[model samples]
Target: MVGREGVAVAKWLNSLGFYAFVLVHRFPNSETGAQAPLDDGRRALKIMAESGLAPKGISICGLSSGGHLGAALLSEYPQVWTSPDPEMPQIEFAILGYGPISTNAAGRTIIENKPPLPPKEKQELYDVVQPDVQLRSPAPPVFIVYSNNDPVVPVTNAYRLAEGFTKSGAPVELHIFADAPHGFALDSPKELPVSKWPVMCEAWLKQNNWIE
Candidate 1:
């Protein structure tokens, strides 16, 4: 899901002379399905560490499911079994845009308009995965950005996530714009490109000193 986006982002960072590394899966069967983008992010961080690229720390940027993956890295740390990968790169900072965090029981209905899921199957996965972030995990500081006009992932998802972080004593901030739509990075309704989210996103990382 993130290879091309990662490469573009890495290139953007490199243009500013930052050491950016993009992680692509080794072979076929490479899909990071569902919320599995979290694993992909971890693997990328691991690759950087093993290759001695950014051994000590790294910042992560993800959109939609990608953002959810970044959140999962913090909210579900221990349960994540990364096979034989190297030490997990300590996430210094994370930028999440339109991500989902809590996904069961009480919070399932928070999103007023999510695509219908199978009554038993997908909802169970939500129960299994998202709630693991109920303050049980050690989290890095986070930046949550959302567009209130999002037709897909409701803006409330971002608000709820920020609330969870705050309740857990995790430093988190949110930015909500009046007009923007789902997957804005791909196609924005505004005259400007949705890709501009990365501009403020990168600034957020630097503001927190997660990246130089």
Candidate 2:
């Protein structure tokens, strides 16, 4: 279910004079496997590039599982992420909101109820696609946001990703909001400081020259 928050974020970006594309995909279950979502994300990027909307570059912004897919696209497919068809625009930056970048760690918690895979297979799966494991040097700039009070995905996932990006010498900005629950999105309580994430994000984007 795409919430009003998602639409609000898109509209906010549009107001900032940025073209926003929201890509939605079916949940990756035991039958579909994890690769399906990644493929879907790639197809969306391809379509956007071919559409001629973003010629210089594109910035991806994702929340929750969407964030995970964005990270996978950037990390696992470095060749495509870094150097796509000359006709296609490259991914200049990414904004991730409460993403579980480490599949293994998240599997133990968020995906524990899903179909079970053997230890070796799980490890192999993580090695191939987990954003934290797949992170490399010269990656595109990343902006990560998470809340310490999140009850679903652990806050550590965000820290781990930020650490990995820093270790790889990739430009990264991290924001840890206190007392906000998971899935807050743009609907976070007005009383909470976390509700200002969108404003902070805009500042960050402008500072990085992402917005012209």
Candidate 3:
């Protein structure tokens, strides 16, 4: 789902002179489970650390499901998700675009409706991946963007995440567009104010010193 958008963002970031990497992971199918993407993300970070690309802390940016994955990486996770290497680079900040932070709310519907898994099984999966339940204090700063008209992921997800960050004393910035639909990405029409999200995100990154 995110492949094209991810590559586009990576190219744009690279044009701005930032070293960007797009980590691809397999999607869930009849033969595979859904947890592989999150594991892939952790391994990607570890690889970046090993490659010496991020001597300083690293920042993450994600769209849609990728955004959900980013939230998991930032929030507290079970020991199974923890890095074995103690010297792993810290996450300085995160940018999430239409991420579904509350897995119980967003996930329950999908799991119950799409999969054949029982309620008990769905609950267990939600326990492992839900960002809202896993949020911890002193988390890295976050910038979130969403559209009220988004039919895919509700704007409430943005509000919940921003609220979590505020309560945890982590810096947060949120922008809610009035009319853009879900998965607008960087292709938002010029007339729609949501098209300016990229500029706003870049400004946020500069203000936080994540970008020069």
Global lDDT of each candidate: 0.62, 0.72, 0.74
**Candidate 2 lDDT for residue 141:** 88
Report the lDDT tens digits of candidate 1 across residue range 116-199. Answer: 455443343355556224543466677787888776666777877887777766688788877876666534544654546667
- The TM-score of candidate 2 is 0.81
TM-score: model 3 vs. ground truth = 0.83
By TM-score, how accurate is candidate 1?
0.72
Task: Please list the Cα RMSD from the true structure of every candidate, rounded to 1 decimal place.
Answer: 4.5, 4.6, 3.6
Query: What's the candidate order when arranged by decreasing lDDT?
Result: 3, 2, 1
lDDT value, residue 204 of candidate 3: 85
Against the hidden true structure, what lDDT does model 1 obtain? 0.62
lDDT, residue 144, candidate 3: 91
What tens digits encode model 3's per-residue C-alpha lDDT throughout 80-160?
A: 545444343577888888876663543445333644334443334445677755765677898899998777777778888
Ranking by TM-score: 3, 2, 1
* Candidate 3 regions with alpha-carbon error over 4 angstroms: 29-32, 79-88, 103-127
Tell me the lDDT of candidate 2. Answer: 0.72
